[model samples]
Target chain A: MTIEQIRKTFDSFLEEHLAFGQPEGLYEPLHYLMKQGGKRLRPLLLLLATGLYDDRFERGLHAALAVELFHNFTLAHDDIMDEAATRRGKPTIYKKYGLPSGILTGDLALIYAYEQLVMGLPASLAIRLMAIFNGFAVDVCRGQQLDMEFEMREHIRMEEYLQMIAWKTAVLPAGALQIGALIGGASEEEAAILHRFGLQLGLAFQLQDDWLDTFGDEQKTGKRKGGDILQQKKTALVVYVLEHGSPEQARHLLEALKSDELQDAEKIAAVQGFLEVSGAKAAIDELQRKYTREALAQLASLNLPEARLQPLKMLAEELMGRKG
Target chain B: MTIEQIRKTFDSFLEEHLAFGQPEGLYEPLHYLMKQGGKRLRPLLLLLATGLYDDRFERGLHAALAVELFHNFTLAHDDIMDEAATRRGKPTIYKKYGLPSGILTGDLALIYAYEQLVMGLPASLAIRLMAIFNGFAVDVCRGQQLDMEFEMREHIRMEEYLQMIAWKTAVLPAGALQIGALIGGASEEEAAILHRFGLQLGLAFQLQDDWLDTFGDEQKTGKRKGGDILQQKKTALVVYVLEHGSPEQARHLLEALKSDELQDAEKIAAVQGFLEVSGAKAAIDELQRKYTREALAQLASLNLPEARLQPLKMLAEELMGRKG
Candidate 1:
């Protein structure tokens, strides 16, 4: 099935399956967050990976839904941890409801995600999927923890930042693909290759997000430009500037990030200028391109027919090509 | 093995296995909360249940640890939701570490709990346990949600109160015992009986806790007298008073519970007098006894020899006898 068809199926599953229980306070926020749509990229990856190995990708529907629910669970909790007020251009659950409801709802989502996971798979396959899912779940938490820690520290290495994002952002995608491959009856070696492809693709996707947060058109991205700069987030561009820029450039960039005197617009402009002048913007672009190429290389080496892999190739292009 | 021996083994496993990973901000609260230590009742129940059917209770060590960790995870998050400053007479994780840390640590503990669960069990058994664990996990969240909802509303029915406590406080114990029985090679029917046994015992334990909260010596309980009264918690005693008291008596009790003009001691004495005069206190005591009898009846019907059931009997007595 094509990625669009898979997404349509997944959306219907979500609509039919995501019902609220009693106590509106606990379950309402969950319904609200799930309705505030995302790209559904992780579930699509799972479906595409399954389709690559087996025609009966439909058998992996629960796993696909599980991945999407788990991803949203992380997002809901991470919003609280990050003190984020908005998600997908809508009020976050934490902001819309309160902290207790936010935390409880995320928890319910996680439990429901697990429930979805073990639904239809055989016992052995369910156990394997659980092991993989739990590993990635822990990785996501660790990544989030590191991200929070990094905010309080004055210095962080580029390598450390990469590791943090890989955990925070990449592992879910990689796990989704690997789980789908397993469900599709792929050998461990083949799943490993798909995992690698997913990891690189995820990295590129995140870098693109980081880039778009500062550089893309606001209309396309559905967000204000330079949001990362305004928040003083240490994205790839910021980390590159910190590590590779001249001392004066680094000092100016740091001051721009820390200055409460500057308005949001001024801060964004200053940080953007620093990134451009210090060549960090170009460097981040290069890194994004390199990872994208690496991901495609892994896909090419899979030896699957191009026609069968067309959906995944199209997805890769769309992810990398996003102005948003 | 005896309950004491199982507890000792479990403690050693905790010391050896509960190590935290990087980013102390996220992990330190977990370490602190685990170290604060509760009765270790849930894990003990698991071990005893395992011992009931199999001598090699050691094989269930990881599951025992998983239960304890998951319990602590619930405690950490619950304390935050309750806005509770202290647990076991020590500052709560939220009070000590801050909100984000409390939430994140709880998430980490839950993830680690899953990690612990999937370790060393056969695939089939692990899958079964996962299904059970996930069911109770959702139940706990649902229970907590109902509890928070209860706090806001003035009137709560006795049946609703019973259901709330069963979800909030009883299921973990039930799940623990049931899981242990499964690990011990019990049939599904046998596990179901143990589950019912646990449910009734858990209700007795919670009612005892409510009884102790107001009436037990402060020194023994390590908390202020009339804590539930002060908080206006809808305990079994309060529920009985509301359900059975004369209209005038119920009015007085409700006013005493809500009056800000009354001193703490006065409120406690007034509410206690109402409970005594209306026979609500006696009713709650009778209910506790009835549940305890039901629990023991289930145990007796299990057909296990008296010698094999001694530990569980002792445990039930100790739980019902706790002043603290």
Candidate 2:
């Protein structure tokens, strides 16, 4: 089946399983946030990686739900921690219900994610899955912690910034692919390669996102250009300037970011000019391309038929492509 | 070894395992809360239960840490949800670190819980333990949800209140005993009996706590008399008055509870009279005794040697006996 069909099948299963709890307030926010929709990228990665080794899509459904619910759980709590009002263009659990609901919903989702993981599996597989999933969870938590701490500080090293992004955004896809590959009978070595493939894909995807938020066409991206600049988010572009720009250029960009009086449009324009002059924009664009290329190379390192590799290749390109 | 030895070993193992993660803010709260210790009762029950079958306190240390961490995770988040300022006579994570840390700390502790659960076990036991822990977690979440919802409404059925109390306060100890018994090679039937034993013990423990807060001697209990009454908590006694009292009595009880004009001492005295006249105090006390009796009966049904069962028997009586 295609990824679309897998998504459809997964959604039906998820809807049936998710609403089984009592206390209406506890589970409703889960359904409400999930219904708002997302790329369903993590689950798809798991399913596709499973397909690459063997057809266990039926059993893989449990794993697919595990990653999906885990992702949503992070989003629910991250929204609360970030004080985010909306996600996927919908009001966050915090905004929609209250702080208590936000905390509880995230918790229930995380526990349920574990339930789905070991639902019908044999003992050995369940043990392996639990270990991998738990590590992935800890990495994400550490990433979020670093990100929150970074918000209060004036400077962050490029190495530290990359680790934060990898933990926060990249590990889910990487772990999903690795988990699915192992479940489908891949050797540990093969699973490691698949995880690397996903890691690069995830990094490229996030870097491209940072680039598009300021540089892409609003019509094509369907988002206002400079959204990141308006929020003063320390995206890859901002981090690049901090690492590589001249002192005057870095100071100018930082001042513009901290300035409340500057109009949003003018700030965006000025930051864009700084990005261009500092060579930061081109460097990050090159970095995104490099990761995309490395991801494909990792995919090629596997001895699978070209047809089996086609879906992952197309997805990496779609996510990292300049067209957004 | 005695329960004291088990707790000390468990503490050392827990400290070594818990502080491994980084980004100081994320892990420090866990350390802080764990240090401000309680009775360590759940882990004690687990270790003693393990002793009842085979002495595996070494391996049971992991299970002990899992339950202890799970309990603290609940406390950390529940404090935020309840807007509580202190736990175990110390400022709570919410009071000390703020809301985001409270949420994130709980999230990390819970994830760490799953990590310790599967750390070094054989596949089958780990699988069984995971399922049990996950179910226990969901029940507590549902219980907390109900408790929070109850605060917003005026009336709740006795049955509903019991379910909430059982879910919130009973499952941790129950699950701990069940897990440890199974690990020590108890049969499914044996584990079930142990679980039921812990369940009743937990209920009696919590009910006795409520009774003590309102009805026991402050000098002996070491808590202010009528503390729960002061908080206007809808505990079992209050639920009984609402369930069985005359309309005028129930109305007066509730009005006195809600009235700000009543002196604290006068309000406590008035509420005590309603409880006596309505038989809520006696009924709840009887209910607590029933649970305690049934719990001992469950322990007796287990065919373990008398010497093997002595520790748990003594502990139960220590917790449930009215001597204090």
Candidate 3:
């Protein structure tokens, strides 16, 4: 089935299952965020992976919802930690409700995610899924912690930054697809291969995100260009500039990034110019392509029929090609 | 085994199993809270319930730790929500570490709790335990939401108050015991009975806490007398006064409670005097006795061997007689 059909199936499942219309403060934010949908990439990937081994999409629906819910839970809490005012073009949960409500609702979302994870699967499969789900959950939290810590630290190596993003952004998709593979009757070896595939895919995905934030058109990305630059986020581009640039260049770049004297637009333009001069933008793109190639290679090693693998290949390509 | 022995075993298990010494900021708060070590009541109840059916205490150790970890996770997050500065006579996680760290550490604790819950258990039992654990986890969050909501409202009915505390405080104990029973190989019927028993015990436990906060000697309770009253918390004593007193008396009590004009000492004395005059103190004590009796009766009805039931009865009695 098409990704759209898979997303529709997952969407209806969430609407039917997620608790609603009670305890307005707690459930309202939940409904608000869940309804304001995004790419639905994780769930769609999960379903497609599951489809490769099993035709019974219904079997993977709850697990798919579980991934989606867990992803949103992290987003809600991360918005609070980042002090982000908006998400997906709307007020964040912290802004829409309040801090305490945001925390509680994020917590509720996580608990419900676990509930969905174990809903109707056989005991053996449910236990396995939970183990994978929980391992990634902890990794995601740790990743967020490291990201927060990075903001306060003075220096971060390229290796450290990659590890951070791998934990923060990559593992969820990796776990989702691997979980899908397992639930779809893949062997342990097969699941491990898909997990590797997802890890590379996730790396490429995040790099593309970093690329889009600075270079993509606002109309297509649905976000202002260079928002990350303005926020002084330590994206791959920044890391690249820090690593390869001379001491003077690095010092100047840091000054330009941190100077409150500069207007938002000025800071972004200055940082972008520095990145261009240092060839950091091209470096980041090259790294993204390398990971995307590695991900496709992992897919090739799986020995699945080419037709069955088309959807995943298309997803990886679309992620690479996305303006957003 | 005695509760002390069981606690010692659980502590050792935690030491061997819990991740430590890495990501100091995230792990430290978790260690701090877990090490501070309150009553450890939930895990003890779980062990005792498990003991009723089997002496394989080692089998339930991980699950017992899961309960303790989960309890601490709630305390850490709840401290942030209440903006509390201290817990168990030391600085809270939020006070010592900061808000974001506290939130992240609590999240890690919760994730690790799930890990502990599923460790070493067979697939079938793990799934059953997880279902029970997750259900109460959601209920506890709902209960907290209601409790927070209560602070903003003018009036809360007696029934609503009971339900709130039951969800907020009682269900965890109820679930812990039921889970222990299941792990100990109890039939569904037996687990249900223990659950009912635990519900009554939890209700009595919370009411006793309400009584102790207002009336018990501060020296013995390790807290100032009337701390709850000072915070204007709507406890059973206040609920009783509202239900039993005349409208004029109730109005006077509410005024005295709400008035920032009164000194803390004067406010406590006024509310205490009102409770005494309205016989609300006696009424609360009576309710506590009723629940305790019902709890003990449920235990009796379990019809276990006399020796097997003694520990639970002693626990109930110890809880009732505790000065703190």
Worst 10 residues of 1 chain A by lDDT: A19-28
Interface RMSD of 2: 1.0
Candidate 3, B1-324: lDDT as tens digits: 777788788778877877774456677778888888787889888988888899896778889999999998899889989999998889999889888888888888888889899888899999889989998998898899999998997677788889989999999999999989888888988998999988999999899889888888877777789898989998998888777778787788889899999899999998998888889888888898899999889998896998888887888899887554
lDDT of 1 by residue, B1-324 (tens): 767888899999988898567766667788898889888989899889999999998878899999999999898899988899988879999899888888888888887887787688888898899888998898898899999888887677889988888998899999999999999999988888889999999998888889878777787767677889998887878878777767776677778898999999999998888777778777878888899999989999897999999999999987776653
lDDT scores of the candidates, listed in order: 0.86, 0.86, 0.87
DockQ of 1: 0.72
Model 2 docking grade: high
Error (Å) of candidate 1 at residue A19 is 4.2
What local lDDT score does residue B220 receive in model 2, on the 0 to 100 scale?
A: 77
Q: Model 2 chain B — which ten-residue stretch has the worst lDDT?
A: B13-22
lDDT of 2 by residue, A108-135 (tens): 8899899998878888988888888988
Model 1: CA > 4 A from native: B219-222
